[model samples]
Target: MWHLITAPILLPMFTALLIMLPPIHYSPNRRRWVSMVSSAIQLVLVVLLLLQVQQQGQLHYAIGNWQAPFGIILVADTLSVVLVCLTSFLALGAICYGSAGEDEKGSFFHPLFQFQVMGINGAFLTGDLFNLFVFFEVLLIASYALLIHAGGKNKTKAAVHYVVLNLTGSAIFLIALAVLYGTTGTLNIADMAQKVAQLPASDLMLVKSGALMLMIVFALKAAVLPLQFWLPATYASASAPVAALFAVMTKIGVYALLRVYTTIFGSEAGALSGIAADWLLPAGLATIALGAIGVMASQDFRKLVANLVLLSVGTLVSLVALQTQQAAAAALYYTVHSTLVTAALFLIADLIANQRGKAADRLVSGRKVVQPVLLGMMFMVGALSVAGLPPLSGFVGKVMLLQSVTDPDNRLWLWSLVLLSSLVVIVGLSRAGSTLFWRISGSDTVAETAKPLQVFAVCWLLLASPLLVIFAGPLTELSLQAAAQLYDTNTAVQLILGQEVTP
Candidate 1:
């Protein structure tokens, strides 16, 4: 159990290697089965890790048992443990779905998928800035390959854009790392936090520049405001399971932002405190508006789902900018809800495309689906959930977010934009759903049906939202506990700095 911290990262890595055996001539089913087993193993590991964090407080594992500032380490706090568990659950759903013939489109899909999981888990667990960059690169490379897995001209073109944009962002990330190391003489996050706390107002500007650059890089990955242009085209054009898996990717940026700020540049820091919140508010509002516009203007379902993903990011960023512990907890809650919802929506898009034949998820009517009643119901639930309607996790998350923003300075503005955005989301989804489902012109042609496995995959994701709602009390309590830990950075600093602290 003490060695289980490595399980989440290593399981997927070893599975990926096994998947790449050239002489095995792995069949599609075999690959899917392997991926499923690997993901199940990861899911169990992460769940146990989450329990360890809760019971043991925080768990640390250093590579090769090298101590302190020299060796690589993995830290699992409440926040990171939650994220890893969510990532593995979604990966499992994606593996189950991808196995339904989509993985057959590219020979390397399963291996890349496993690598992608490894990267995501590593990113969440890494204790140093440099390792975070390495994990980012690993995930980005796998995503690039996965995007073009089915081999479409449009997808290839979009993958090119994705690669180019991320490469540029990576360069910026490296520059920021160099600047921070030059200024503070450390890349370990807790070490840097100590240095930043001691940094004077006069000497802080250089480090501030580096922090801003880090923010920009994260924003690019999060698709925040102006940096978001690359996501829709890339995600919308990709295969369904690939797109579904990418759903968790943006949340990684949000996680990085929260992690870095709380540990290094948060309220505990002198000049860097409130820096991100100051800018994130306006930019996040703008992003919500931008995503709403994209949703309305979208001609197809894939693009619409992509826009919804962006909108969710904006919502969380804006709430995060409120800069309170409750806000942080609310953001965490919504992050889980939105990730599950986004993944389900993406899978639904692909499922609906099959049943619609030439209608193919377009706004226009072409043919009726064999399972319109079921699919339509699922879409409505997703839409209502995303729009923050009642009796769902989204509604609970939104209410908590609103409650968290009781700061008299910005409560009205927060309420106004959030409500207005919800209205836009509802109207836009209503129009699109009616157009896609109600205006169907009947065709005599038999519609192609989605695989039973694919349907199960979608159902798995769809049910998570309701489960979140069912367990909202415990989940909210957990998120609040996680938020308290983040705000209580001293305990984290002690652990990360290798001081003798209780587990």
Candidate 2:
């Protein structure tokens, strides 16, 4: 039962080790099966862990048999569980999509994919700042390999820029961690949260500077405004499944920001006093505006997805900036919705691009349209969902976000920006949708031959979109509870304080 708490992290790591063994390494087919089975097992473990955490409240595990303040800890609170589940689910989807063709099922792809998931889960569950840095390295290295797997000149160029930017960010992160460790004499997050407020003003200032520097690192990862230039170029050049996987990667940055700000810095009265709640609101608005403008101006479907990714980040950051419980809850819900819809959109783009290429071949050789109706319907559903139409998960999230921040008079400016951004997203999606599915020139005799498994996986996700909305009540409640866990750390402090004083 206790091991279930660590299963999310352990499962993928164990799977990676197994796949790397000599026997599995010898057979590509066996390796693919091993990868799929391992990811399926990981998905199940994540579900079981979520159920256990729901029943038990919070779960913690000590590494190397040492207790907190003395050794490493992995905490499985609601926020961590939500993120773990999201990562595992996305990994499973990407694995399924990657298993289809010869290029996708190559020997090198699955191991890196497994390692990426392990890194994401480890980062979410880790209770030490240094451990988080280690996990980030694991994830980034895998991503670099996956991004350049196609081995084109463009992908190579993009991967180099991506690697350099992320490495620079990693260096900044290490420096901040060193400053933090020197100031607090501890690396455990929970322990640092406890001591942050008691530090002298000078030391506290140093800590805040470190916090701000760490924020910049995460901002680069999250693709927030000025730091977001690399994302469009890099993601646009990656393969579709790889791009979809990268969607979940940005959430790691948002997760870190929410965790560090609310749990570590927000707990410090002086620090909270120094930074006003609405301080980031204007910057978030600026990000949203920039992303919207970029999307409208972009011509490629891949670049459009990149811009949409930025827009989602801006939306989440703006909600976080609002700093209300309701706003936090809305942000949580929106993040989940955005992750799913964006991934689906990328997969749909892949299908569209593949079909277009096939159509071009058919035109050159004069053949029939290959599964036009199926492609058309998939396109319509994905486009509308991304555009935030009603009866879809996107609509539910957008409505909640709008409802959460209804300050009629003074917030008119904010509402206008939100509305304008939504409209821009609609236009961007519509143009891409029309061009990809409807307006593309093709023959009527083309044969539809996409892998049945891939089509089934895509359909499963499409069906799940509405189901997410249908189950939105319970999921929303869970998100609200998770948000409470993040914003209300005083409960743990009170529990600790009520215990007998120890030397």
- Return the top candidate by TM-score: 1
- lDDT for predicted candidate 2 compared with the true structure: 0.76
lDDT scores for all predictions?
0.87, 0.76
Tens-digit lDDT string for candidate 2 (1-503): 88887777777777778878889877777777887788788888888888887898777787877877677788888889988888777777777777776334334787788888889999999888889999999999999999998688989999999999999999999999999899988877767677776678778678877877888898888888778889888887888778888988888887887777776767354554324235457667888898899888886777787778888888887777666678878888888778877876677667666656553311122233366688678767766776678878888888888888866742675678878888888887777665655564444544346677678657755775787789999999998888887776665443323222111
Best lDDT goes to which candidate?
A: 1
TM-score of each: 0.97, 0.93
Model 2, residue 498: distance off in Å is 9.1
> What C-alpha lDDT does candidate 1 achieve relative to the native structure?
0.87
Q: Clashes in candidate 2: how many?
A: 7
Instruction: State residue 443's C-alpha deviation in candidate 1, in Å.
Output: 1.7
